[model samples]
Target: MPTSATLAQPAAKPASRRGFLASAAAPLIVPGSALGLNGAVAASDRITMAAIGQGPRGQFVLGHFLEQKDVRMVAVCDCFAERRAAAKQVVDKHYGNSDCAVYRLHERVLERKDIDAILTAGGDRWHAVMSVLASRAGKDVYCEKPISLTIAEGRSLIEATRKNKTVWQCGTQRRSNPTWKFVVDVVQKGRIGALRAVTTSFGEGPWRQTGVPTEEPAPDPEVFDYDRWLGQAPWEPYSKLRVRLWRVNWATGAGAIADMGAHYFEAVQWARGNLLELPVEYDGAGMFLKKPGINNIPYFYNVRARYRDGMLLIMDPAPKGVRYDGEEGYIHILDDGRVEASPKSILEGLPDLSKLPPPKGHWNIMAPHIRDFLDAVRSRGTTVSNPEAAHASHVIVHAANICLRLGRPVKWD
Candidate 1:
């Protein structure tokens, strides 16, 4: 990884994953409901599960886990009381049992020995933090996108997952979609002629921080441990926007390009046949709106990077999708499950289209990806959206964010 004046190290390790779990042992007791699951045992068929960061995304991911008879969601954690309780309710309701444990801190969940794997859908800052800890604790991980807030954190996260031999999958669920696979295969196999460029877009986000509270509030330790949510992020006074709206802030997330563009460029990397390599250089300009919607992340931006292979990736303002241009034609992929190619007959160009996978029923977006993660857990196989690939795509846009932040184009080493 290259050093930059734009990317600075945080003051210190907020807390070591191992150290936090070890010291919190006395308080983080296993819930009585989790005990005596021995009767529920069905050999290795079941994956004992714990969930952290039970917000909207957390609750959603945990619901998918509970749908499987082979998954036992023993514990869940969230900084907010209402959300965590809501998660436990979902678990308890599913199994018709209150054996599910509730937690405010993720360290408690990590300290538990019962969980085989952890499903995390937390804030962008906590993604890398908890993934590293979960890896250290000898558990597989299913984490959300923009795996880390910065390129440096992503590199370290890759190290942890690789070292622990953890079966890790990022939450860029499109990778599991049969349509996306077919597209990647087509692009990689040169069915679209020689690939030349990729155009990805996510429209525009709130440029001006509005509809959010700007005043820093006193931390309500009882209602929500603001400090815990702010972990790994620099210490700052509690602002409703800072905690909840942190997703778009550069301090806590990589803004739209890395956070949302993660999906777009990741597929670009997949089609480009270089998932782990980043562009050698990138240049970009951004519109830093003075009207505040939330934080400092650009409300709108554009970046262009040239991969070493001379393939160009352009992210411009438009609808949310990736369009690949090649000599044969252009293929456009959207998140809503729309894939289009030029000449109309390009779909027939694939000699093995019959051998390619059939559509997996109706695409719910999250379902297939969850199925892949659970299957990997049972079979100990690699997931299609493993952490390594996530990291590579992450760095692509993360480097772009740096360019916007530093107000200069960057040369990535």
Candidate 2:
């Protein structure tokens, strides 16, 4: 890994997998939920669980964990009272147990010894804090995407999880899917031929920042724990735009980079060998297009990450969609479907895809990822996309945001 003027310490070489695992070893402090299972039961054995930030994404995570038979929904937490109660109701209906506790603050949930694992689906700002707090409290964590707002925060989250000996998974569910895995395998194996470039396009772009319009405030305004919500960031007054669409504002979010760029940037890096300490250079921009009902400028965005090895990664939201180009041919991955090289003998020239196991069902992937974390709790196996990998992807996205904001090509340090 290399570092540039703006980046952190020069990227250090990573230890071997074995060395990394040995270094991660630490004493485990089992939560009550994990201990109560007695280590003698199967998936049928009950494992109590809790959720923090039970908003839209939070509820979805709760549902995923509930799919495992051994897991029992034990607690739900959220700053928003309405959302918290809604998640609690869902948990009760699924578990048929109304006794499960619900809390307005996440710290109370973390303090509970009965909770085995925590699903941290709070806003982007809360992602790293909740994960670090939960891990310290002896709970496995399944935190949602973009893991952190900045590269520094991501590094801290990864280190804290290792120190606490927590089995953690960043919620990039696509990583659990087989088709995407197959795509990555193809790119890594040079099936696409000396991978020269990758281009990713997210769905248009998010709303842009315009000062909020004045309006009468609600009577019982949802008094969000602004200080707690701000956590590491400075505390400030609440606004509809900040509360509803914070991603566009830098103070609360990383705009599209931390939001959408996280997904495609990760896909690109996973396809490549690894992320560079810094890119050779970066260039991109956000413009507002005059589309009906759309107020933001530059609804479209694109970035080109030039690498030292001549390999290029282009991220753009365009009509042409996502594609990877190589010396021999290219692969196009689109919403409708995937199309590999059409040249005769291309499939024949590749390694035996048939030898690998076929993809599991859609819902099956997350279950296995969850099981992988659980197994690692005892066996200490490496997670598929550990915090290190997540952080690397986050760094790339962070750079992209810098370019979009400055409206100038950024030179990586």
Candidate 3:
């Protein structure tokens, strides 16, 4: 889960991409400059990459980039010493390159001129600031899902990226998966016949927290700055789960809705024709499957979104798994390691790549996402989960949270 962080400082005005391109095109430095080997830095050369957050998802993203020979892990950043250490080990084990820098502060990583882009899995609160700041620092960014904490934040990120002309990619990898994309395309093209409703489910609900150890000593102030970690949200005692597992907290993360629902809601938008077009309203509830822990929140969350066009979307925690119901037929989108589509007929004669596109090698599909970002960076083109599409998807998750908070289905205007 991406943890929110306080902004270290406002962003610097980014150098124009055209200026960078012109500088590269000209032989100002000849073959060797301060960094050395100017001509050697071809477009096909290894891209210097960094990982800003090394939690589960962040580590997963790091693993994806390691598979490609054209990329190198030059740096990593994480607030938690343990997570940082874990990520560094993974980098060392997987990266073909021998030496890489690791830092506790993301700002330090952003300051490196050699790093071409960053793989960010920071807390939800940090999404906008980290992404925007990275863009301003002249680095491409591939940040995780639920792109923003608030509607304003989402819009701000878009503006920041546009202003900086950064290559921004969101962690909505399903967009790149051929199978999922086909499902979405079919739904939108009326293969489902007047798509009336779409539903999604995930999670066993929030984990009930046990009381924190009353006398547990705080982590070394030098290693992990607690104040910096809290950022914008109200302060609270640092619990293991609270700091590392911050996704369970409303202040730091979006609970299960923002954590898992972001993916589902984004898919919902993709299925319906409202991804770019906003929704009519969000109606939902965040209720507990168990008692709240140090961070009180619903372990299980359910929601139903109604669009103005009368299309309804229902999503609940995967009852041990997930499936989709369509107007013409139903599709089973599962979490039980099972991948089955509706009417088997849809994929009967589909080609190998068309049907399964190479299992991203990891259960998590973000690897292909990393590859897509690298490709887009070279092509100077938009990726499947571009910033705009991601921004729209985030609104679905944000609206869902708002509806639950307000205890009413607020209209989307």
Candidate 4:
């Protein structure tokens, strides 16, 4: 593994393609389509990109990137051979060429000077570390949610992106949903009156384990690099269940709260106008599986947190989404893009959601969010789900987890 100092060293700048073409001894002819003719974006003008982690979620997001005309995905990296191959096939098919490169290690992808951005959708264990490394390599990042396994890791990612002047967009796609945008607008515009409390739901947790996992022989390195897949996670005996269900394990993932909580919390923060702030106090209780299997995360939890301004936030396993309560009325934003409100009048003046354009495709509701990141990358601007907001959201969940594990209240600084 490379040290932070080594990876953080500034990468050498690469020569521009136009400059190289200009200096070529022989005159090379190129297709008009390659130079932005016939409504196609020019190769030099497109954002050169690569992807790390080609699991189901990763591939899903990669599909969105493929839809963008201004994004050129040149490479993909994954520890699993099948995943990388599948991702490469998709990329190649989209471009009608076999030019998409594949690698098992992410460092190889990061070393490419021509790549301007990276899309990291690996497990929770790899999110922060990979983003930090990509930032150090001068690559903008679009990372999946639950961006860190711990508060410290989240903080490190924020610091690295800031130090490297990287543009990062966390995968909290709800921020781009029209319903959510309207919710934030309503709250911020004081339609809900002075916001007093928020109740957000992140679904149920891991199942209880009944038996211990037996150690098994690891797979061949070519098939799956188990060691690299674990990344910063502690070494554990090779077990298929561990890899398949990493979210239930403490060492590799942070369970339901960190998984879904990231989205809900970010929504809460945005609606409350506290994107850069964290709660000052946290208290929670969790029901952990008493069995001795690999699963250690809680099966259910309820957390109560308070911001410095006395606003209350509650995280629980019910309600299916987020609900904001104010002095006058309350508004509820459901997980399926449905919005409900009390006294009914609070929703009267809201925009007609039915008239807005629907999501592009199945499971591609995040298209707008992805577009936001790519636009920011091109213009050197900030994204809605930027690193600071991501870190703050991660800290909220990690702090709640600590309180639950300690069975005591935790005071934040």
Of the candidates shown, which would achieve the greatest lDDT relative to the real structure? 4
Per-residue lDDT over 1-413 for candidate 4, one digit per residue giving the tens place of the 0 to 100 score: 65422343455578799877777856778988689998889998999999999999999899989999999998998999999999999999999998787888788888888899999999999999999999999999999988998888988998998999999999988888777788888889888899999998876644454346678999998899999999999898888888887887889887778877888889888887778788999988889877677777777888999999899999898856889999999988777777788878887877876765453331248788999999999889999999899888888889998998898999999
241: Cα error in model 3, Å: 4.9
Question: On a 0 to 100 scale, what is the lDDT of residue 54 in model 3?
Answer: 81
Clashing pairs in 1: 208-291, 208-292, 208-293, 209-292, 209-293, 209-294, 210-293
lDDT of each: 0.78, 0.68, 0.70, 0.86
lDDT of 4: 0.86
Using TM-score as the measure, the top candidate is 4
Candidate 2 vs candidate 3, lDDT winner? 3
- Backbone clash pairs for candidate 2 read 3-413, 4-413, 5-413, 287-297, 287-298, 288-297, 288-298
Report the error of model 4 at residue 67, Å. Answer: 0.5
Each candidate: RMSD to true structure? 10.4, 13.3, 8.6, 5.7
Model 1, range 256-352, lDDT digits (tens) per residue? 7875677777788878776777788899898775764556777777899998888888887787778899998988876565678897777774645
- Supply candidate 1's per-residue lDDT for 207: 42
What is candidate 3's lDDT per residue for 134-196, written digit by digit as tens?
999988999987677788888988888788878889887766665666566666665546767
Candidate 3: which stretches are off by over 4 Å? Answer: 1-44, 95-98, 205-207, 210-216, 288-293, 320-326, 336-363
